[model samples]
Target: MDTTSNLEEAVEVLQQLGLKEYEARCFVGLSRLHSGTAKQLSEMTEVPRTRVYDAIRMLEAQGLVEIQHSSPQQFRAVPLEEATETLRDQYDARVERLHDALETVEIVDTDDESSVQQVWAMTGQDAIENRTNDLIREATDEIVLVVGDESLLTEDLIDTLNEVGNGVDLLIGALTETIQDRIRVAVPEATTFISGLEWLHGENATVDETAIGRLLLVDRSTILVSSIMPTTREERAVFGEGFGNGLVVIARRLMAQGLLTVRDPKQ
Candidate 1:
């Protein structure tokens, strides 16, 4: 109801993230204090004598408050701009370490299988495309693509893929008329299909000539199969290497035996 009540709630949320009650209180109280001590802070912020020392200690540790330790510690808030800049540096370092640890865990050793291949799961649209392009650029022989349509692929991305040239055999599934025309404009050399692939019709795409969803085969070693939300517009694609179970194994076998026919788009 009270407009200031919303800001009070936000301050509580920040306090929960590790800000001390006295630190939070002192920081908020400081704007009112202009500068104050344990007693003044206690009076203004409604903090108690028994808990003030503990609160001051927490605030001091956070660098949000400075302590002028005399008979009693006089506390004052660090300037807001300085406090924020200090916190940003601390948080950035913690985040960098976390990212390094996650990247290290991408490959794990399993007792059941030899370490010949690795599979990774990439989330987000940009991440999926980056991993897909990595596979294509790394490919020595071919790149088999089963993508949704041209609307999904931007003009710039298409240009980069086209640089792969004849070394990449692009097998594309156009989910709609829009995709087919876009594909033609993007990669005139790619093999195109209009039938058995699911989810194409809603986008006005022709069905695949074979049963396929989103399958991208990279030089017969890496594969990505996407799962689309049947109801929503969002889609997720999973990337796997040759040594995994289920679809990875089956697709790898198909690519090995040359069963998934590689016909030229010209045909």
Candidate 2:
């Protein structure tokens, strides 16, 4: 590891790609030279001269190195572009094999899948956004979403909202009129409103208290409510799917705050 930062970094990356420590060092050492002998690779990489030959043989088997059988022996790494492509293909193949191997495992859950109402918790902004978009896509009758923060109006969410089928009713509410206006232009087909939920961003709120993030009610059945935690400002969400479930019912009421009467999900 007592080498140039760039060389050390290259060796670390190669090891992460499934190369052994000595193999990575040898491959990286050879990469810097058009051709190198065992002694030269050992001196450059700090790997034992005796181990260099073994590492070179493994690298050659993996199509990362080419060996010239001279009296002492010579080794050269494959061209950088070709070597990268080979590694990528190898990594992809390994991933595919792992997926295939695990795909056949049977679920061991003893409880019936639908016997009880289930609520799952999720964290992270990207994950919450993806789950919200998925719920929107699955809506057959209605998709009601309330944005508590303007920052959550990402292009991906807008794209997902715009892609909703014409047959589905799409209602989007923003905490402020300006955000509502943006939503209106971004998705003209949807009805946009300025939310009446004052608690989402009350005047007394401070950095120590959690803030409302986003609320999504799809088909009046599936519900996702996320909150931004204090201090770190990390997003977390709880998702539940079931018509007439308590969580779903509460979300429906909350999202339909400004309306005179809440529409029945079944209707």
Candidate 3:
């Protein structure tokens, strides 16, 4: 790269490593020249001569540059590899300090009755998917899932359910034999049932004549219900957790009453 382009790139990288703009520019300029007086560095880069000494002092404190004792003090950048290693170590140390500081702060405990009973609404497909994945990952014993749209049964969701193994009870409405076959292949250990829920046949039916969206109950304590709008590419979901949450109770009862047992041939 040309001198200007090379300096620009180096300054960008150094700034990302937590150096100030002037410090980055000066250090890069000094690196290029091997050793240079502050005046020369300021002229080579965009740093003003007055600011060059301050930037060099900061770089020296960070162990990135060394100053030579002479009539006009010269600054030399540490070797590139050594500089990068020093930056990495400083970055890691800062991260460790931040982690320690965060641990010392008090956070509200949300596992109690009041917090768990609060229903939260989430919009957009990505947000709903992330919440669903979090529920799946946190499920300790059982997961009851009722899917209205086959498309909502993404590969990542299937993999997560498969990882949880036999504790998952899946009830999918209006699935064809082909789609059922795909689910079987994806999660071989889970009990997959076909639900004859009435919603699958009406005007409010999801795409492909399935039920309207999905209902997920994790360990019977957490519940999530989502509505899918295929034409508009919109998704809305509400979720809450608690032992006696009304949503969780209703969803569990609905799944038990509406779902029909489908015996897998292998089982």
Candidate 4:
């Protein structure tokens, strides 16, 4: 993208990672320079000159910026590689802390177990992917995944599939042979096949239709199916756990075609 857009995106990302606007702006400004005075950084980033020092100090404390001791203090972001690693470590630590804190927060128990199965709906690509990965990680017996769209075969999903413990079968189906080959190469242990689920990419499919994204069935009990909205391209999914769940039945019915047909292919 253009320089201005890149700078804005960088500032936005840094802010999301817990940096204040001024700190993020200052860091982005310094990232483009070897070293610069507060006034120069202010001019480049549009952060007030007086506030640049505050931002610089905060960034320095976070190990994102290095300040030179001089008459007019010079500031610069840490090397890109170093800065990235630092940010990753910080982000991971924060996530760990959040996990720990959340784990300790007692859940208020409501209703007891019911005969009815519950299906959960969730939005956003990252959250869906995380849920899929979590299901894969938790799989003890088998993982059956149908990739309706090739883009859903992300590196994180590949890694999770690869990490499935021994004796846990991994069956991955793709709508196209090319994606099957790609999956086989990336995950040698996985059984990859061309899915018989042609309706996922049927000729009748149009721009107005909600496109299938990914289908994941773990241990024959849990199921997650995501679809991409036609206009927004945003992914939304409904997941259910329990062998008796209607969604589980749907997952089995949806995946039976490919899995049942590929007995000799990868067996």
lDDT of 4 at 239: 91
Instruction: Please estimate how well model 3 matches the true structure, expressed as its whole-model Cα lDDT.
Output: 0.75
TM-score of 2: 0.66
Candidate 2: give its CA RMSD in angstroms. 5.1
Quote the lDDT for 159 in model 3: 78
Q: Report the lDDT tens digits of candidate 2 across residue range 21-43.
A: 99998988888899989999999
Q: Write the per-residue lDDT of candidate 3 for residues 1-267, one digit (tens) a residue.
A: 896787789889888889999999888888887799978888888689999999999999999999999989988999989988999999999999999999999998886557645889988877898889888888776676766677788988887777774555543333455656777777777666665555642455445432357788777688888886656757888898887677776766666644543422111
Least accurate 10 contiguous residues by lDDT in model 2: 258-267
Best by TM-score: 4
Q: What is the C-alpha lDDT of each candidate?
A: 0.63, 0.87, 0.75, 0.87
Better of 2 and 3 by TM-score: 2
- Model 2 CA deviation exceeding 4 Å by range: 1-102, 112-116, 202-204, 259-267
Misplaced by over 4 Å in model 1 are: 1-112, 115-120, 199-213, 230-232, 243-245, 249-267
Report the error of model 1 at residue 101, Å.
12
Where in model 4 is the C-alpha error above 4 Å?
112-115, 261-267
Choose 1 or 4, whichever is better by lDDT.
4
